[model samples]
Target: MDELKIPNVVCKIEVYAAVNPSEDPDKVRLAVSHVILETDYQYKEGSIKATSNQLNSLVKIQETIKKHRTNKIYRRQMRFNTKGDTTWFYLNKQAAFVDVIAACEEAEESAMGPIKVILHSKDLDKVVDWLAPEMTE
Candidate 1:
């Protein structure tokens, strides 16, 4: 009989609502926060490599956000370049972080829903560790 050994690894997750409360706070803030934190911890302990596309996507998002804020008065509603509000970042094949910015925006539109979220980290393991303490046992 052969004995099987299980690999030891821990996953951590953190959920955050990316909406700015000042814009239009909503009740979904707590829900969205929990989701982001939970997801963050779940994928924290994985081996994933940051890809150029993911990095580029993050940069573009940030730039767009900056532009949006800069010309705030011109646009009545916040708009994202992506078709929907959801944007995701991948580390190799696995997603390191998922930004729910659109979700947050939608939440706001619905009278305080959830704001969008951004997940990012070079070391997935570390992120999980950071989030672990915040979760309920």
Candidate 2:
């Protein structure tokens, strides 16, 4: 995808899930807040099922990844959800936050499931680098 058309700000991107049409916004936002806090999301029994791309959370994520950009990193796609009003691509949380400094080399994969990182075609590189930087010595 062309990288020139992607958005740098998190609010500009979008995400969705197969949530009940009658789901409450406050509930959804609250559920999303949990994911944002833990830096991961997973559907459990009776757990809130919602789709979100909350702006402040996303901005904090962007900043956190930038803060850890200098460390050795791994980037892996956790899952590929179907597209609706928005295209959603989930990523491993370790790719965005954890530092596997004991690996001796960059980890090729991660088990930190369900942290979604929304990427635009135009700004793909910027986003990837933000989350998992391709650095040099």
Q: Best by TM-score, which number?
A: 2
lDDT agreement with native, every candidate: 0.28, 0.38
User: How would you encode candidate 1's per-residue C-alpha lDDT over 1-137 as one tens digit per residue?
Assistant: 12212113232222333333343223233333322332222112221111221322233333333434422321212223222322222111011123222222233343423333333344433322222112222
For model 2, residues 1-137, the per-residue Cα lDDT tens digits are 21222234453343322223554444444435533433344444434333344344444444444456532333433112323322334433332333221111212333422334443434444444444454554
What's model 1's lDDT at 127?
Answer: 26
* RMSD in order of candidates: 17.8, 9.7
